[model samples]
Target: MRRSAPAPQLAKAGLEVLGEGVADELPSYEQAFKAVVNVEVAPRATVARSAPGASAEADRLWLEHARTAAVIDDEGCFLIRGAGRDWVRVRRTAHTALSAALVPGAGSMVIAMSPDGRRLCALTEEDDDYWIVVHRFEDRP
Candidate 1:
């Protein structure tokens, strides 16, 4: 009988197949998330809250309270998303480029990059339930 390889190894191989010029060296999830702190969030106007009965003051406060992190993939492109929003893509090689903010909903986001740096994922908790969101680098234009 043939034995299957470990999950981690299989994942790495899959990434290599999908990644764009991905290197053999891949950072672990822990390391990837830790590196997220290094990516900076550009200053922007305060975001407004769309919830019913939410006041402008509440929206301003929520924007201020929102936390953000960025995960740099193996290709040097980074994915950034804040609480209750979709991921934003930015390239390290580019300067003066701005990423648009996405629709929001997930609270207190935690990010992780796939081994080949081809995917960005976020884990969030709401009402004692956890959710995962994934964004593929190749899918972006």
Candidate 2:
């Protein structure tokens, strides 16, 4: 029997997780905002472009396959959308005052956040497997 080679780790996108309790430190408001924006929005265009008349089931399937994440800001929460490596779109909800911010190559299923709203923990994928990824407002450059 032959064994398969180990999957390669993706490049560090500067949003790598530091560890538990790292989120205790608070980030500046600007930094927090930027982190919230740095996520991908769900790719609705693919379904629209490929099948204008796609059924409800198709929509559900697309969402199931696409990678997703979320982050919170002073205004509200943001939904991040992606496929595997990076985010592509961000959607803002639960707030009327804040507007949506766009950032390329940032997406995952954000599962946790720091009490100070600086650090974020998300579930992302690498080579078809899901893994937890931590992101912080301070990590943004």
Candidate 3:
């Protein structure tokens, strides 16, 4: 059987992930992404206790896996969810222009996305270590 990746604790260290996964009439990645960020995937039945009186509630969160899509190109990025889940496509737009251009250096990773399906992607470059550039496309009327 395939092994599932361990649960990942949420951390906003320095990662800016971007991408799009929808078209004119589909449930796109941009939509899902808006609600998901610095996401923490927890394991089912895994007990986690916070402060006192945190309440002993049943955990509905399961350790699904956490990963950001690679910046494949200027057109889009790809994300693979749970098994059998269709590949999510993060489309790009003009907002991407600002994103791909802003990191600290050419080697820093840049992530861009729009609340709308305008532009969403992460531009990755290798600096001595690694840095993140973030941008989100805004659809102006």
TM-score of each: 0.23, 0.23, 0.22
**lDDT score, residue 93, model 2?**
27
Q: List the residue pairs that clash in candidate 1.
A: 84-104, 84-105, 84-106, 85-104
**How much does candidate 2 score in TM-score?**
0.23
lDDT of 1 at 17: 22
Candidates in order have lDDT scores of 0.34, 0.31, 0.28
lDDT by residue (tens digit), candidate 1, 1-141: 111222221221111222233333443344444433233422123223344533333323322222222244445454333122322233333221111111235334345454345555444333332333444445322
Lowest-scoring 10 consecutive residues by lDDT in candidate 2?
Answer: 95-104
When summed lDDT is taken over every stretch of 10 residues in candidate 1, the lowest stretch is 94-103
TM-score of 3: 0.22
Error of 2 at 113 (Å): 1.1
Ranked by lDDT from best down, the candidates are 1, 2, 3
Tens-digit lDDT string for candidate 2 (4-53):
22112211221222222322234533343344344542222222213444
lDDT of 1: 0.34
Best by lDDT: 1
